[model samples]
Target: MTARGYPKSYALRRGVILRAAVHTTMLASEPALGGFLAWDGTDYVLNNADGTYAAITFDGSDIVGVFFDAESSYNPYVSGGAYDIEIFFRGMPPRLRSLAERHALAYNRQNYQCRSMALITAAFWSVDDYLTAAFPWEDVFRHGAHIVRVELLGDTDEAWQEWREAYQCSPGQLAAARALFWRDLSK
Candidate 1:
C-alpha cells in the first residue's frame, strides 16, 4: 500500500516520488494521516518506511504544497551526481502557487540549495503532447521563470554525459539552449 493508504496502482508510473506539504492546522485536524509523520519544517518523510516515502504539506483548508529530497534512502536508483531533467508548467494554479510559496520558504530556511545544478530543456508540442511528456516542462515552468536549478539524485556520470551529448549542451550552453528550446516549443 502507498502512503496515501491506497494500494499501489499499476497505473501509477514510478520514477521520482512526490509528497505534499500541509500547515499545522491541517495536521492538527487530521492527526491520523498527519500524525504518522513529523514535519522537519522543510520536507516530510515517512516515519516507518525504509526511507521510501514522499509527502505533501497542506494548509488548514487545502493542500498547499509538495517536494522531494536527494538523500532519501528508499530509492537507491537516485544518482549521487546531478540528473538533467526539466519541469514545465502551463500556469501556476492557486493550490500549486500556495505550495510553491511554502516550498520556497522551507528551502530558504533550511538553506537547502542544490549542490549541483541540473538543466531542463522543455518545449510544448501540444496540450496533450505536453501532458503525455514524461517530464511536463510546460506545467512545471509556468511561473515564467526563465531558468530553474534542479538536483539530480539518481543518475551517473556516463548517463549524464550521454544526455548532454544528445541534448548538445555543455554546462555553459545549457541555459541558452534551454531558452531557445522553450521558445521554439512555444510556437
Candidate 2:
C-alpha cells in the first residue's frame, strides 16, 4: 500500500492535480463543471466552479465505486456557467485526518456515507456560511487562493454533442478530443 493507504497501483502522487470537466446530466440543465479531482483515502471531491462540491470514490480511475454526496441540491450558479474547484492536499495535516475519522465514526452511526453529496453539500454550505458570516466577501477573497478556471467537458456521448455544438468544432477537431484525456507525459 502507498503512504495514503491506497493499493500501490491505485495511489496517486502528491502535488499532481488532475482536472476534468464533468457534464452533469443529473442536473436539470446538464451543467458542465470543473472537477479539481483528487484521490485521497477512499474519496475524491468534484469541486464545482460555484463553490459547490461533490465527493465520490473510485475502484479505479475509470470506475466510480461510490458517490458520497450524490443527492445534493445546492448548486452555486457561477457566471459563464463555468466553475473552479481546487483540491488542496498539501495543507491537510494528520490532525485533519483524525478529525475526519472522528467525524466518520459519528457519521457512520447515522447509516450514511460521509462522502456522499448530500453531506458534502451541507459541509460546503456550512463553510460558506461561516466565511460570509465572519468576514466580508473581499476578506474571504483576499485570503483564498485565486482558482484557475478549467472546462470540464463531459465524456458522455450526449455531453459531447452539447460541447461540440457550443465550441463549433469540425470533425477534424472532434478527432483530437481523445487526445485530451491521454497523458502523453505518462509515456
Candidate 3:
C-alpha cells in the first residue's frame, strides 16, 4: 500500500499508464509540448534510466514547464550527463528537486521570462507527491499551465499541500525526514 493507503499494484499500474500517456503526448509533436531548447532546433532532453525522456515545454522562447517522465530523473547538475542516474529508485531527493527548481527559476529570470515553473508528473512514484507539493500551484493559469493541473494533484494547491505535508510527517519537514525517510516506501 502507498502512504495514502493505495495498493502497491494500483500505484504501479497507474504509473505505467501515465508514462504511456506522456510518451504518446510527446510523440504527437505538439508545439506546446516541444522541448525547452527548441530555439536552436534541438532539445534539452532529460533522459531516464529506462531510455525514456522528460522534455521541457516552451511558449516561444520562454520555458513554462516539464513533465517528470518515468524512472529516476537524470542529474541536471552534471552537464553531458543524460545517462547519469539518481541513487534512489522510483523517486529523487527533495534537495535535488529544489536545486533543479532553483536553476530553472534562475534560467527564466536571466532570460527575462516568467518566473513560474510547473512540475507536471503522474503521482505514482514514491516521493513524487512529496516533491510536487513543496510549492504552491498558481491559481491563475498561465498560457502553458493547463497540463500542470493534472489528475493526481488536488483541485487546489492548498488541499494538495495539506495531504502531502501530513503524509510526509511534516510540521517540520526536515525533522520528519530524519525520523521517517523512506519508512513507508515499502507500502
Q: For residues 74-159, could you state the per-residue lDDT of candidate 1 as single tens digits?
A: 11234444333223223445454556445432432221143433222221111211112223333323311111111111123443
- List where candidate 1 sits over 4 angstroms from the true fold: 1-36, 39-45, 65-91, 103-187
Model 2 agreement with the true structure over 139-186: per-residue lDDT tens digits: 222222112112222233554566557445567555554344344225
What are the runs in model 3 whose C-alpha is more than 4 Å off? 1-22, 25-94, 101-110, 113-145, 151-187
Please give me the total number of clashing residue pairs in predicted model 3. 1
Q: Which of the two candidates, 1 or 2, achieves a greater TM-score against the reference?
A: 2
Q: Estimate each model's TM-score.
A: 0.26, 0.27, 0.24
lDDT of 3 by residue, 1-187 (tens): 3344422333332332333233333434344434332222221333333423333322222222243432323223223343312222124345544443543322322111233433333221223322222222221122122332332332234533543442342345433432332232333
The alpha-carbon lDDT assigned to residue 91 of candidate 3 equals 42
Candidate 2 local distance difference test against the native: 0.30
List the candidate numbers ranked by lDDT, top first: 3, 1, 2
Q: How close to the true structure is residue 29 of candidate 2, measured as C-alpha lDDT?
A: 34
Best by TM-score: 2
lDDT of 2 at 91: 32
